[model samples]
Target: MKNTILIGACLLFAQQLVKAQSSSYKPVEGKIMTEWAAQVTPENVHREYPRPQMTRENWVNLNGLWNYAIRSKGQAVPTSYDGEILVPFAVESALSGVGKTVGKDNELWYNTTFSTPKKSRNDKVILHFGASDWETEVFVNGQSVGKHKGGYDPFDFDITDHLKSGKSQSLQVRVWDPSDEGPQPRGKQVNNPHGIWYTPVTGIWQTVWLETVPEVYISGLRNASDIKSKRILVTPEVAGIVDGQQVKVSAWKDGNMIAEQTVNPAEMAKLTIKDAELWAPGNPVLYDLKVELLDGKKVVDAVGSYAALREISMAADENGIQRMMLNGEFLFQYGPLDQGWFPDGLYTAPSHEALVFDIQKTQDMGFNMIRKHVKVEPATWYHACDKMGMLVWQDMPSGDMGNGWEMKVGVLGNQSDRDRTPESEAIFREEWKEVMDDFYNFPSIVVWVPFNEAWGQFKTKEITEWTMTHDPSRLVNSASGGNFEMEGTKITGDIIDLHNYPDAKMPDPEIFGKDNILVLGEYGGLGLPVDGHVWQQKDNWGYQSFKNQDELYARYAGLIEHLGKLVEAGLSAAIYTQTTDVEVETNGLMTYDRKVIKFDVSKMKSLHSPLYNK
Candidate 1:
C-alpha cells in the first residue's frame, strides 16, 4: 500500500510538470501576425494528417512543445535544454515561442517523448518527417535511427528495432541548416534580411509523426492518369513482399467502383474508366483510389489514395504561335506569383486553413493558376490545390545565388550556365530530383520551373532535358525569367517566359512563339500597404506604390485590359508579381497580415474575365 501511494504521487508530479511547461508556451511578440496565430496552441498546432495522398488509420502526431537547445556546431549533445519550442515552426519564426536564429555556427537539438501506438506483432513502427531543413539526424532511445538531407522532401525511417520495452519512447533530433552559408536549395532565405530575401528558417519547419504498419506493407503509391487513354496507372511500392503477394487497385467515382485491377508488386496496375471526366481548373474532378496488398488473398495492408485524369501540353494556334493547353483546350492561365511565407510561421502556415486561405482568395479574385515562386510548399497545400481546381506552376526552391547574370534578351550569345563545384552540382541534382519525385502524384502541378532568374542556374540544356524526360506528362519551363539557352534554332525548353513589372507585358510572339509558348511569367506588382497591415511601419515599397483602393484598382484594371491584347497576340499565361505582401515588399493583392484585400473580389473577377475569353 505504501508503494502504490508513492507511485501515484510520482504520476501526479509528472502531470503537473507537463502542465507547467505547456502553460509557459506562448508565441513570440513584436511582429505583424495573422488571425490564425491566435488559434495556435501546443495541443492543437498542425494536428491534421500530414500526408493526404497515401493515408492509413493508425498514426500519432508529434507536433507540440518539445525541449530544444542551441549549441555550437559539432558539440556533443547537451544534457540540459534551454526551453520548450513549438514543433513544426522554425526556430527564427514568431510561432516557435523561442524566436532566435541558429546560424551556421550552431546546431539545433530537439527532445520529446511519445507513447507507442497499439499494434500487432507483425507491425513495424515507422517515424516520418514531412520536412526538415538542410541536414537532420534522428535518435530513438539513444540509438541512431538515420540521417536525411534536403529541406523540402519527406523522409522516413523504421524505428521498430530501436524501440524500448515500455509504452513511452524517447526521441532526439539534431539539425543543421546553412541558410546562406551553404549551397543547398534554400529559397529566398538569407543571413541578412534585405530587398527580396527574407528571414532565415532553420531546424524542423514541418510536421513529424509516427505510423504503425504491417511488416510487409504498401510503402508508397505512384498514381497518374492518361486522359487520352481513359486509364489510371497505379504503381504500388511494396516494402517486403514474398511469393504470391499481389497488389489490388480500385478506382471509384461518387462512391461507385469504376475500375479495378490486380497486379504483382511494383508492376503498373492500369484501370480504365469508361467515359472518363477530365480534370481542369474550376471543374476539378477527382477519382478515389483504394490499394490493397494481398498475400494469396489474405490482405496484408491497405491504403487510401486518389488521382485525376488530366493533361498539360503545348499546341500551335491559328497565328502559327504555340499556346499552353489544358486537357487539349487553350484556356489562358492567369494567377499571382505566390511566395509561400508567413510573418509568424516563416516557412509554415499557422494552420491548414491558413494555407488554403490564400488559394481560396485567389480563386475568389478570378485567378485559376498560381506560380509557386521559388519555394515548394507542404503536401497539404498541393492537395488543397488539387481539390479546389487550382492550376499550379511549381518552382524549385532557389539557392546558390552566387552566379553572374546578364538578362539582356537581344544579346543571345552572352548567356551561360553557372559553373558550380562538383559538390554544389551534386547537391542540386539530388534535391531537385527528390522534389520532383516527391510531388509528382499531385495533379494540380502542371508546369515545373527549374530555375528562376538565374539563381543557381547550371547545365541549362542537360537539366532542362532531364526534367522533360523525367516527367513527360507536364511541360517544363527551363528557366522562368532567367537566362535562356538556344537549342539549334529554337529555345531550350517548351516555354519562352519573360518578366515585366508595373505594367502588362508578353514575350515577343513574332520572334519565338512559333517554336515555344509565350508567357509573361511575372508582371503587375501594384502595391497598396494598409495602415495597420503592413509588415513594417515605414520604408515599405512595391513595383509601383498606390495611394488608395480606388487608384490601385484602376491601375490593376488597366494592366488587365492590356494583358487581354497580349493573349490575342499569343501569350498563353501570365503571373502577377505576388499573392500577398512579403516583408518590406508591399506589392501584393492582400496585405502581409492578410487582414485587408486591396481590391473588391467581385470587381477584380469581372476585370479578369475578358482575358480568359481569348
Candidate 2:
C-alpha cells in the first residue's frame, strides 16, 4: 500500500512537470493553422516509423518535447534551456510550441534524454535524423558524434562508442541555418517572408530515431529495376564485413518466394523475376524483398524492403513527335505543382497521415503525376507516391541567385548565367549528388529537374550532361521553364518545357517536336478564396482569382478542354499550378487548411480520364 501511494505521487509529479514545460510555450497568434495542429502533443508527435523503404523491427522513436536553447553562434551550450520545443518541428513553426526565429547570428540547440534499448554484446546503436535544415552537429553523452550539412537528406551516426553504460542517455544537437542569406538550396525559405518566400525552418524538421544493429549488418541497399531485362539489381553495402560473410536476397510476390540469390558482400546480386508485373500509374505492383546477412550458417542481420519494376523513356510516336513512354507506351501525364508546404508546420507535415493525405488526394483527383516544385520532400513522400501509383518529377531546389529569368514566349531570348563562387558551386554539386543517390531507389521518380526557371542556373550544358550521365535510367529536364542554353538551336535536355499562367499553353511542337518531348511544365493557377480558410484574410491572391466555386470550376474545366487540344498537338504532359494554397497563394485545388477541397473530386477525375485515354 505504501509503495503504491509513492508510485502515484511520482506519476503525478511527472505529469505536472510536463504541464509546466508546455505552459510557457504557445503557438503564435493570428495565423491560419490546420486541423492537425490541435492534435499535436509531445506524447504522440511523429510516432510513425521514420524510414519506409528500409525496415527494421527494433527501433526507438525519439520524438517528443526536447529542451531547446537559442544562443549566439560560437557560444557554449547553455546551462539551462529557455523552454521545451517539440522535436522534428522547426523552431519557427507554430507546431513546435516555440514560435521563435533562430537566425544566422544564433545557433539552435536541442537536448533530449532517452532510455537506451536492450542490446546484445555485438549490437551497435545507430542514431538517425530524417532531416535538418542547413548544417547540424550532434553530440552524444557530451562527446561530438558527427556533423552533417544537408537540409533535405537523411543521415546517421553510429553512437555505439558514445553511449555510456546506463539506462538513460543524453543527446544534443546544434544547428545553424542562414536561410536565404546563405547560398544553400533553401527552396523558398527566407529570413524575411514576403511574396513567393515563406518563413525559415531551422533545426530538425523530420523524425529522429535510434536503431540497434549487429556489428556485421547491412548498411544500405540500392534497388535498381530493369524491366526490359526482367532483372532487379540489388547492391548491398555491408558494415563490419568479414572475409567469409555472405548476403542472401529473396524476392517475394503474394507471400510466395519466387526468386532467391546468395552472393558475397562486395558483389551485386541480380535476381531475375520471372513473369514480373510492371509498375505504372494505373497498376503499381510492388515486390517484397528480404535480405539476410549470414556468417557461415548463422544469420547475422536481416532487413525487409520493397521495390517496383517500371521504365521511363522518350520515343517518337507514329506521328513522328516525341512522347514520354511509360513501360514502352505513351501515357499522358497530368498533375499539379506540389509545393509541399503547411500552414502550421512549414516544411514538416503535422503527421504521417497528413503527408500521405496530400498524395492520396492527388490520386483521387485523377492526376497521374506530381511535379514536386523547387523542394525535396522526406522519403516517406516518395514512398507514398510509389505505393499509391503516382509518378513524381523531383526538382533540385535552386540556390545562389543573380540569374535573370528570360521568359521566351516565342522569340529566342538570351539570359546571362550566374557565375557562382567556387564554394557555392561545390555546395550545390555535392548536395545534388547526395540527394539523387539517396532517393534513387524509389520507383515513382521518372524525371530529374536540375534547375527551375533560371533561379541560380549556371553552366547549363555541363550540369545537364553530368546529371544525364550520373543516372542514365531517368530523363533529365535541364531546366523547367528556365533559360534554354542552345547548342546550335537545340535545347540541352530531354524535355522542352514552358510555363504559362492561369491557362493552358504548351511549347510549339513544330519547334521542339523532332528533338525533345514538349510539355506544359506549369499552368492553370485558377484561385478561389474561401472565407475562413485562407492564410490571410486580405491580400491573398493567385495567378487569377475567382469569386465563387462555380466560376472556378468553369474556368478549370475550360483549361482542361484547351489542354486536351494541346495534347493532340504533341504536348506529352502538363502540370497545373499547385496542390494546395501556400502562404498568400490562394490558387490551389484545395484551401490552405486542407478542410475544403475546392473542386469536386468525382467530376475532376472524370474530366481527367479522357486525357489519358485519348
Candidate 3:
C-alpha cells in the first residue's frame, strides 16, 4: 500500500511538471520549416533510440521538455528556469521552442527530474547524451557527476552513486559554446549568419537518455573485415571483467548462424565464414550480430548489433592510373556534398524519418556515395547508410580560419602551412581523434578527409600520416580541394582532389594521373529556390541559379556529360555541391523545406546512372 501511494505521488508530480513546462512555451517562428515540423511536439520529440550502433533494451528516454535558463558563464545554477526548451534541439533552433543565443560569455542551463528505474545492486545507471555542443558539465542532485568537451562526440556518465534512495532525482546540465570565437571545430557556424554560414547551435542538440547496464558489461566493439580471408576481426572492449567471464560473438545471415566465436575479455576474436556475402552499393548485405557477456554458462549481458563484410583499397587500373576499388572491383563513385543540417533543427534532425529521408532520396537519385561535409552525424545516420548501402567519406569539421591558404588547381603547388598555436593544435588533434574513434566501426566510411580547402590545414604531413597510421583500413585524402603540398613533387595522400564551381572539372590528368587518384571533390552548385520553401525571400543564392526546372535539368545534364569525360581520363570519384538548401544558400537539389525536388526525379536518376558505368 505504501509503495503504491509513493508511485501515485510521483505520477502526480510528473504531470504537474509537464503542465508547468508547456503552459508558457511556444515554438520559435522560422521563415522555413520542413513538413515534419508540424508533427513535432515535446511528448514525441526525437523518441527514437539515438545510438543504433550499440543499443540496450533497458533505457529511459529523457527527451521531451526540460527547464532551461541562459545566464552568465560563471554564474551558479539558477533558482528558476526562464522557460522550457525541447530536448535534443539547440536553443537557437526554431524547433527548440526557445530560440535564444548563449555565447561564450553566457551559459545554457537545463534542469529536469526523472524517476530511477528499479535495479539490482550490481546494476549501474548510465546517463548518455548523443551529443552536446562545445563544453558540458553535468550535475545530479546538486552533485557534479562529470564534464565533457567536444561538440561532435557522444558522451556518458555513470550517475548511479548520485541518485538518492527515492523515486525521483534532479538532473542539471550546463553548456558553453564559443562558436567561431574559439579555435574549436565548428563547421560553417558564425556569430552572424550569412552565405555558407548559418545560425549557431548551443547546448544539448541531440538525444538525452538514461540506460542501465550490469557492473561488468561490454563497453565498445570494433569490427574490421578482411574480404580476402573471409574473416572478421572483432575487438570487444569489456569493463569490470572477472574470472570466468567470457565474451561470445555470433554472426547471422538471414537469421541463420553463419559463424560464432568465444574469447576472453581482452583478446581479439576472429569469426570466419566459409563464404561471406560482400557488401556494396545497390546490394547492401549485412550480417546480424549477437554479442553476449557470459559468466560461466549464465548470460549476464547481451547486445544486438550488425556488421558488413567489405573492403576498400586503392590500386592502379589497367592504364596505370590509380582508382578506388571496392571488394576488388573498380567502381566509379559519385554523390553529393551532404551538409547534415536541418531547416528547423540546425545540427539536429527533426525526427528519425526525416534523417533517413535525405539518404533515401540520394539513393533514389542513383548516387553511390556521400561526402559528409564537415559535420559528424548521429550514429543512426551511419547505420542507415550501412543498411541502405551508401558509401561515405567523412570530413572533420573545419575551424580556426584566417590561415594562409593557397588555391592552385592545375599546377603542383606548395602553400605555406598554417602555424596554429599549441593550444589550438591540441584541441584539433584531440577532437579529431575522438571523432575518428567514435565513428570507426561504421563500414560505409571509405575515406577520412582531415582538411578541406585548407580551412584549418596545419602540419599536413604529420596529420595525414597520423590519420593513415591510426586507421590503415581506410584511405586518406589529406586535404580535399586544398593546396597540394608536395614532398619532392609527390602529393601526400592517396587522392589528388580538386574543386570547381558550376562545372565538372578534375585535376590535370597529365600532372597527377600517375601519382595519385584524380577526383573532383566538389562542383555543380546549381540552385533553384521554390516559392514558400526558402529560408528568406531575398538574398538567396547558389553557385549558379536557374529560373526554371527545364533549364536546371539541361545544365545539370551537360555537367554530367563532362564528368563522364573526366571518368574516361582517370577521375575516380566526384561530389556535387550539396544535398539540400541550408539557410540562405539555395544550392541543394531539394529546397530548404524538403517539400520539393527541384528536378524531375526520374530524369535525375537517369542522368546519374551513366556515371557509375565507368
- Give the 10-residue window scoring lowest on summed lDDT in candidate 2: 405-414
Going through the candidates in the order shown, the clash numbers are: 0, 0, 0
In candidate 2, how many Å is residue 39 off? 1.5
RMSD of each: 2.3, 1.7, 2.4
Instruction: Find the 10 residues in a row with the least total lDDT in model 1.
Output: 406-415
- Badly placed stretches (over 4 Å) of model 1 are 1-21, 409-414
Q: Mind giving the per-residue lDDT tens digits that candidate 2 earns over 322-395?
A: 99999999999999999999999989998988888899999999999999998889888898899889999999
Tens digits of per-residue lDDT for model 1 on 380-451? 999999999999999998888777666575323235778788998888889889989989999999999999
Worst 10 residues of 3 by lDDT: 405-414
- Clashing residue pairs in candidate 2 (N, C-alpha, C atoms within 3 angstroms): none
Q: Residues 431-505, candidate 3, lDDT per residue (tens digit)?
A: 899889999989999999999888878998899989999999998999888666676545788888888798888
